[model samples]
Target: MRAAEHRRELVTLAYPVYAELLSGVTAGIINMVWVARLGGHAVAAVAVATNVENLLLGVIFVAGSGTTVLVARARGAGDRAATHSAVRGGWALWAVITPVVAVGGYLCREPLARLLLGGGEGGSLRLATGYFAIALPGIAVLFATNVVDGILKGMGDTRTPMRLAAVANGSILVLDPLLILGCGLGVRGAAIATVLGRSAALACGLVVLHRGRASRRPAEAAECGIGSLGADARRTARTGLPMSADFVVRMAGALALVAVVARIGVDEVAAYGIATKAMYVATMAFYSVRQAAAIHTAHLLGAGHDQRRAVGRQALLLSGALGLSALLILLTAAPWIMRAFGSQGEVAEAGALYLRCLGPYLVLLACFIALGGVFEGSGASPALARVTLCGTTLQLALAYGLSGWGLPGICLAMASSMALQCAAVGRMYLRTGRMGRTERPPATGSEADRPWIPAAAASDETH
Candidate 1:
């Protein structure tokens, strides 16, 4: 049996990373809540601008994804030289990538905002452009933070980023009004505040890593050891690429869904803003488990554990629990949660109703995420990306079609899509037999499933 403390250590590391992600998101939701009253135009602007930002975030996600794989494997293998080398290489790459993203964001801001917001003459286009312009230059901050964060995550240090996120979000809370209504910054102010918060997060992460300092002592201390960063960037690239693809493609589809919603009118957009916010809170546990399971599975795969099946099973089980928990929260909090966000009774009612519809489908959402862990662990990122492509495409198509039916249509569309996506992914996963100890039939298994087992060498045992 695994030591109680060992299991807890894994859980502990995952907690802060999840919290960091959720807290920053919470801050965004609160910010959006206040923005909703400013006007639907403003809400639409923020949504489009945020989606643009997420697009950029998807690009850098590969860097973090690569870092996590490198860190997990190197540390698992006790290769101190390789770990430090990777740390240095990661920093070097970000120095180049950050500025590139920032400049691109700055230049693309107006056109992209116009496109996503659909450029109405109501001055909404100008407002969204304003937000996007300011948000664009801060790409450097966002890039730097995520890259450093990936390194930290690889090291099993989720809390460092989480604490930093809290600081960043707190700054946003303080700076939002100062820039927006106070100095007459409006959307620009909000954008600036977000940028500064990201910069702060990057700064905190830098300090944490430098202090932790890479060591070539894996031969001496089992835990602190890491392999050389001498591994090909291409390999890291190959590993992380699918993860980035999944995020980027899925986000692209999400934005497309938003664009469709925009056509339904700003009121629908505002309603969605409120509902999505509530949904995120209700769904944090799912996000948390998926992230934790992915990282843990990566480490386990690296360590050559014999329990791939067990790990996969546990991750999925955790995901189901999380999804069920989200459902209960959605069902129970549907009314009050909506009421808390928007002052408009109809908006609140619509959002609450939407949440209730989304409740059961949380099951599908969680399971899909669990499957992502398997792909990440096995380094079959192509599979991971394909899974995302199929699921998101289906979801997007449904969302686009159902949106014409109004609020319920939008909710049902996405929820139903999630169900279909999960089933598709789960079926493929079972067929692959990557999750289990034996190359047993998937109840009926992917081409990768064979009689051969890639066992960790006898000398590589962790404890």
Candidate 2:
């Protein structure tokens, strides 16, 4: 495909993903808004609960992301049996994982809340436990919905997932006030509202999945022979585990960075928190492009094309533009952005400075993150995950050493770490280009031993 065509397809896939991501963030903010009226303890309880939810999201990525790449590849190769196996793999993994998380989490709700709340014996601890009691079980709904979204995205339908997110968030928006205040259910009500909203969306998503062509199986597909459930589950887990590790490492690194920021002083820590939230707006856009690139690259590869170089180039271009735009916006409007978040005085000044200093780091992070999708689609994610782990460890050490210089020093550490990561991934990208030219695609069943050729591509390479 032409460069312009590749860029256009990426934009088509990315924008809806961006919207869906932004909406989820927006809903979280609004959900907090409703909880804030209940007082500081209430706010604290819900905040900690939601943070746990974010971590749990990384766990479920095993099913969701793995299914997406596999299904997209199968679709491109027109392998109906492979597609069926991929979908089953996702659900099987979900089934095996959900009970452990949901039921176990509920049983340990009090202990979990105490751990999260620093073992405090207070109203906040009690509220948090109550919130967990409901939210933990409700996680089953969230996991299933993510699988549905993954399947839809793999089938080249990003808009539907965007709409489904809107449906869920909209329902939460309507339900929050009614349950939290009107019914006097407190933090538990917020948890209930979230679960109920997600449940509604899950119902709609299942209906959509049933009607979609991707979920259908004809007699011909039966002839193609579906893999056993254990085999399918293992395949999906192997494909997705690296991606999930990458996400969890990043999340853990971000959390640890907060502790490093705290060493600078409480005001700086507050500033760091608000600034990071604002940064999410841009980061989400970069991730959307990454997702789009992964989908497009996997699809093309499944169709017997080695176009990773082309897709990675476009992903970098798109994400670079977004990063540059965000940098300029932050530089020009840092103070205003801080004010919008309700910070003032020393806090606002510190946050504005932090935002202004974030330009280089954001740009490098955009490129690194975007390139990662190409690796993921081509079955090179294990290497990508290793780089991420090393980079994150380096970042924390650098940040700890540089805390003396305040947020700007911290920004420098982040930028330095991300630059090294980008160089690493850039070398990998170049190697793939060399391999594409010098080597034939790997044989079928040999993908496990290869680095760049995916299983689907291995089967379809002759095309």
Candidate 3:
């Protein structure tokens, strides 16, 4: 495809993904708003509960993200059996994993709540345990909805997932007041509302999936290479585990950075917290482009095309523009942005300075993240995950060493770490491009089931 065509396709896929992600974030904020009315204890309870849910999301990515890539590849190959296998793999993995998480989490609710709340026996601890009782079991619905979304996105339908997110979040918005305040269920009400909202969306998603089943007919087991339930599940897990690990590592790194910021001052920590939330608006856009690139690259590769270089270039350009636009906006309106979040005085000043100093890091991060998607689509995610692990560790060490200089020092550490990561990915990209030049397109549909990376590129990444 032409460069213009590739760019256009990426934009089409990315914008809806961005909207879906943004809606989820907005809903979480609004959910917190309603919970905040019950006082600090309620807020604390919901906060920790939601943080646990966020971590749990990484676990489901094994099913959700793996299905996306595999289905996209199968679709491109026009292999109905492969598509069936991919979808089955996602649900199979979900079935095996969900029970352990939901049932085990429920049984350990009180202990989990206490651990999250620093082992307190206060009202917050009780509220959190109550919240967990409902939310943990309700996670099954959330996992199912994510699998539905992955299937849709693999079929190149990003808008449907965006609409589904809106549906779920809208339901939450309407239910929150009624359940939490009007019904007097307190923190448990918040958890209930969340579960009900997601369940409603999942029902609708299932209906959609059913209606579209004609396109994904049942296939002969012999035609689907890894057709057995166990084999399919294992394949999905293998494909997605690296992506899940990457997400978990990043989350852990972000949490660890808070400790380093604490060494600066309490106000700085508060500023860091607020600033990070604000930064999500920009980061979501980068990730959207990344997803777009991954889907597009995988689809094309499955069709026996090696267009990773083209897709990566367009992804970088789109995400780079987004990063530059965000940098300019933050630089000019940092104070206003901080004020809009209801911060003031030392908190606002520190946050504004941090935002202003974030330009280089954001730009570098945008490029690295966008490029990482190309790797994810091409079966190079293990290498990408390793780079993220190293970069995150380096970021923490640098931040601790530079803490005396305050938030700007933290920003410096982030930018430096991201720069190194980008260099590593860039080298991988160049080597892959060189390898692609000498490669022939796959001659059969079964070849689509194989990893996309050439031996030369894979060898380079391993070393």
Candidate 4:
């Protein structure tokens, strides 16, 4: 498709995907309100435990994304063998990562919670641990389900995932309170409910991926098929590491907020929470579109086409559109949304102010997201990680140094860091024709196994 045609296609493909994001966030918002009704500790426990879980899951996502990039483009190139290779690799990836995390999470739940809740006397740590313990094992099911979903999406099948997401969200919304206070399970019950909901969603997503999406023929997906385990593992590891690192950068970046925003008090914290919810609703949709572009770019490059420029342009345009919409929502409807989560009036007001302050943030973040996709699609997962780390590190430094000024200063720090990150990644893409480390350098004795990094090709031609 031409650039303009591609853009329109992207918008169409993204609508249902975007709805998935919106509904998912809506479910979370409802869950939060219900949990909040149980009192501050219950609410706080959910927040803290969820953050830790996100951090762990983010790490896992790095591997998952690698699986998506590898599988999507292979499928796009019309190579049935390579397509299934990527899928198998993704499953293997979860097999490796999930168990380690579950066991570690259950073991370290106390210390992790203490660190997250800051050893407060309010029983926040215990509550967080209770939540984490209940949620840990269920994570395995979540990971497996998502791997199948990601593989399907890599092939341009988003409708099934969205449908699954709706069911998942509905289940969570209904189950969150019922299991928590209803079963006298307390905060642990809420966590249990989320896991169950996720499992249900996973089941739905898996069915669609295996049955509704890929070719029903067993022979087509030979590349990612079960037998090519060695090849899949090698490629997935090389790519997944950097992607996971990017996740690390994000989690670390979020921690910077604790130092910067903590001084503004719990109300400010709650407000930021709500604002973040809104931000995710807007940005995740944009991200879904970006993922589609990544798949497109990978396929094009794999076909020896110079469509990278077009991919870059479309990604930026969509990101900009989504970011602007987020800003508008934040500025106009912050107060209205803030009214629902009323632990304190001041907190709600502060959150409303936060929504306004962070409005322009979406623009800066758009640059970061699109660039990262460019990097990932081009087989430069490590480069994307480096870029993210650069910006996140800057945020941490400024957050600590500027905390004396207040929460708004932290917001400024975040914005500045984003701008710098975008500039850095964009420059790298323009000059290198791929992000740094476009793909992992081949391991010794495995020169034939090298990933398809475009910049490496351009360089070889020059020599």
Candidate 5:
């Protein structure tokens, strides 16, 4: 693709993804708004439950992301059999995982509730259990929707999934009040509303998958060695596991960093939490770009191009612009942002300080994350995952060692680690550019399932 074309394609794919992510945030906010009418305990209940749901999302990525990469690659290769196998693999993985979570979770609702709320018979626990009783069972709908989204994105149509999210979350915004207050189901009503909205969306998604452009390929085309269902599942797992681990590792590291912040002071911890939450606005934008890059990279690779260098450059440019914009916003508006959150005194001061110091980290993170997408799409995610683990560990150690300086120290630690990650990714990018289309050794089993290969590798040519 030309420079202009790359920009256009990346933007075309990215904006809808950004909208989809924002709608998800909107759904949570809508739920919170309605639940707040019940009381603080009810709000607390929904919050904790949603946090757990977020973690569960990571589990589902094993299927969703795996399917996306495989399908995109297949589409690029014009391999209908591989596309079919990829779709089946995603569904197969979902089927195996959903029952364990949805069924087992319902049976242990009370214990799970207790675990999140620290074991109490308080109103929060009661409300949490009530919410889980409905939400846990509804995990099937969520899983199916996610799989559908993955399949569509793999087909190179991100717009439909974005529209689906808007439709489902939009319904939740409309139904939450009617179910929660008007229908008198309380917290359980919120869960029901969410499930109903998502189920409706899922139904729409299935229809699209059956009739959409993604499914239009002729069935009698060459198989291109698409694996069997079980093999595909394992391959999908292998391809996606590193991406999943990267997410989980980041989450775990963030949580651990909170503990490190606690060593400073309670006020600092509160400020750190609030500042981090605020940072998500910027971070999610970076991630949106990352997803766009991944999808585009995979699609191009499947189509027999190795434009990782070009893709990486464009991704960095896009994310770097956004990151710089965020830096300016945070720098100029940190005080007002803290006040907007109703923070006061030391909390506001500390948060502003952290935000001001956050610029370097955000810029580095945007570059790293966006570049990491190329690695993911090209089946080099294990390396990215290793870098993430190393960076997270280094950040925590530095944070703990620099706790005396409070939030500023934490920001410095984060920036330092991110810088290291960027450096590592840069080296890999240079190597890929130099190597061009050199053939790699043939992979076995799950690794062979990866659809991406250098031109030589795919063409059966020896190096």
Candidate 6:
């Protein structure tokens, strides 16, 4: 594709994803708002519960992200069998994974709450367990919705997922106050509202899955003769494991960094938490760019196009612009942003300082994340995952060592790690260029092992 075409496609694919991600964050914020009214214990409970949910999300990414790339590639190849196989694999993996997290989580809710709360005082622990009682079991809805969104996005239908997110989160916004305070259920009420909203949205999503454009394709009519459930689940797991690892590793690093910051003082830890949430607005845009690049890259590769260089360049450009924009906003608006979040005193001061120091990290992180999508789409995610793991380790080590400098030091650690990650990825990109016209092989062995040749050649081979 030409540069202009590539730019346009990236923008088209990215905005809706940004909206979808934003809606999720917005839903959490809304939940927090309602829960906040219940007292510090209630807020703490919801926060811990939400963090657990975020971890659970990483677990589901195995299916959600795997299905997306596989389906996109197959769709581009116009391979009906491969497309069907990809979908089946995603569902298979989901079927196996959901019950484990949901049921197991419910069974372990109290211990889990204690662990997250660090065996804290009474009210918060009980409240957190209360939330988890419903939320853990309701994770099935969250897991299923993610798979549905992934499938739609893989089929190049980002808008529908965006709409579904709006529907789901919007329902939460409406239900939170009514359920939490009006119904007098408190923390459990918040959990119930969240589950009901997500369940309704999941139902709508399933309807779309059955009757929407992606599901109605002529390719859907073709028999894929996909293998047994176990085989398909394994295939999906293999494709998605690196992506899931990358996410979980990063989350683990963030959580660990919080502990590092905690050594500084309660003020710094509080500041870090609030600042991170504020930063999600900017970071989510970067991730959306990454997702778009991945989808676009996978589609083009499956269609026998080797345009990784162009795709990488465009992704960097888009995400870089976003990063720079975020930098400028944070630099100029740090104090105001902290104030907007209702922070004050040392917490406000520390948060503002952190925001100002966050610019370099955000820019480097955006570039690395966007380029990593190219690797992911082309099945090089293991390499990217390794990079992430190393970077995260470096970040935590640096954060602990630099705790003397407070939140700014933590920000410096983040920037330093991201810079290393960017350098490594840059070297890989240049190496690919030096390797010349040879296609970077797909990351896995299934049908993707088939070499990409001309459409005519592929058809001839099939015949």
- Highest-lDDT candidate: 2
Clashes of 2: 0
Task: Summing lDDT over every window of 10 consecutive residues in candidate 5, give the lowest-scoring window.
Answer: 435-444
Per-residue alpha-carbon lDDT of candidate 5 for residues 150-253, written as tens digits (9 for 90 to 100): 88988878899899998899899889999999999999999999999999899899888777556544353233444556876887787778888898889889
Lowest summed lDDT over 10 consecutive residues: which window, candidate 4? 454-463
lDDT of 6 by residue, 1-463 (tens): 6776787899999999999999999888899999999999999899999999998899999999988988888778777667767787888888899999999999999999999888966999999998999999999999999999989999999999999988888898889999999999999989998999999889999988778556545464444444455666776787788899999999888888888999999998889989999999999999999899989988887787767778888899999999999999999999999999999998999999999999999999999999988887877788889999999999999988888988888889899989999999888876643321212223334644344442323232111
* Number of clashing pairs per prediction, in order: 14, 0, 0, 6, 1, 0
**Candidate 3, clashing residue pairs?**
none
Candidate 1 vs 3: which has more TM-score:
3
Q: Which candidate would rank higher by lDDT, 1 or 4? A: 4
Q: What is the C-alpha lDDT of each candidate?
A: 0.67, 0.87, 0.86, 0.70, 0.84, 0.85
- 416-442, model 3: which lDDT tens digit per residue? 999999999999898765422211122
Clashing pairs in 2: none
Q: What stretches of model 5 exceed 4 Å from their correct place?
A: 216-227, 433-452, 456-463
Provide the global lDDT of candidate 4 against the true structure: 0.70
> What does candidate 2's lDDT look like per residue over 276-382, in tens digits?
99999999999999999888877887776777888888899999999999999999999999999999999999999999999999999999989988877766788
Model 1, stretches more than 4 Å misplaced?
1-10, 29-44, 120-123, 181-184, 213-231, 259-270, 343-345, 399-416, 431-454, 457-463
Candidate 1: global Cα-lDDT?
0.67
List of clashing residue pairs for candidate 6: none
Could you tell me the C-alpha RMSD of candidate 2 in Å? 3.4
Residue-level lDDT tens digits of model 4 in 133-166: 8788777876776676667667767777788878
Worst 10 residues of 2 by lDDT: 435-444
**Stronger candidate by TM-score (1 vs 4):** 4
